[model samples]
Target: MSDNVLNQLRNKRNRPTVEPRQDALVPKVQPEPQTEEQNSPQETSPVPATDNPTATPADTIAELQAELEKYPETRRHSAIVLEKDLDQELTRFCKDRGITVEVFLEAAWTFANADNALLEKITTEAKRRYDQRKRVGQIKRLITMLSNSAK
Candidate 1:
């Protein structure tokens, strides 16, 4: 090849090319300065007392009555005093024994109303001593019998 033609080809290969400017590729976003209110601490409004409401006493009583209606007539008429822990325990105990609180109360009333025939038969202290003596005699008899049988 000619020297001029070779030099021209070499120059074309070695020379740096300028690329077109890309103004459309960049996104334009301006930083906005924070206002005084935005920079300050936010003030939250207090929750209104009326926002979270509860059922009234009348409404609650009605709801309880509705639940009671789902029960049997006997159970509906049952008087349950849920004031004390003992009452609650008694209710649970009655439920465990497959007896209603009403039936248990009725039995208790009947027992209380019954004549004190047993009480009249023995004095309180005499009854205690009699029971103690009876237990002690039985133990003594059991020990004597065991000793004799061993011999």
Candidate 2:
């Protein structure tokens, strides 16, 4: 083979490959620069880095809510379990309703976030007398709302 052809083949073999992207398109909008006097927390959002452990849960949640407002939707971490038949069934159940388990759960979490007392009540089992299945169904509806809200 010619040296030029061999060089071309070698370069092709050494080319770096990009991983298959599953992320939805994110807009290229940039945040405006803050002025010297605009450093107040109320005036400008203080987005903490992911590695900043000092960032409270409320801070993180607020950031997520802001992101949701801007793009209306964003990709998130997900998994596929090959061995868990029940998990597969749950995924299918959500998919059949035009949603994913992540979306369904996110909606439920958002609804729960609206009421701080709800978490305490659930943990304390204050409403233990309530029908378990009924509560589960209610959570499902919340998930649907959350999924729809993102869309």
Per-residue lDDT value at 88 in model 2 = 82
Task: Give the alpha carbon lDDT tens digit for every residue of 14-88 in model 2.
Answer: 978899963222222346688999877764335433544445566667766887898665675667433368688
lDDT of 2: 0.69
Error at 60, model 2, angstroms: 32
- Lowest lDDT sum, 10 consecutive residues, model 1, at 45-54
The residue pairs that clash in candidate 1, if any, are: none
Using alpha carbons, what is the TM-score of model 1?
0.25
True-structure lDDT of candidate 1: 0.67
The per-prediction tally of clashing pairs is 0, 0
lDDT of each: 0.67, 0.69
lDDT of each residue in 84-119, candidate 1, tens digit only:
787889889999999987788768657755757644
Tell me, by lDDT, which candidate is best.
2
Backbone clash pairs for candidate 2 read none
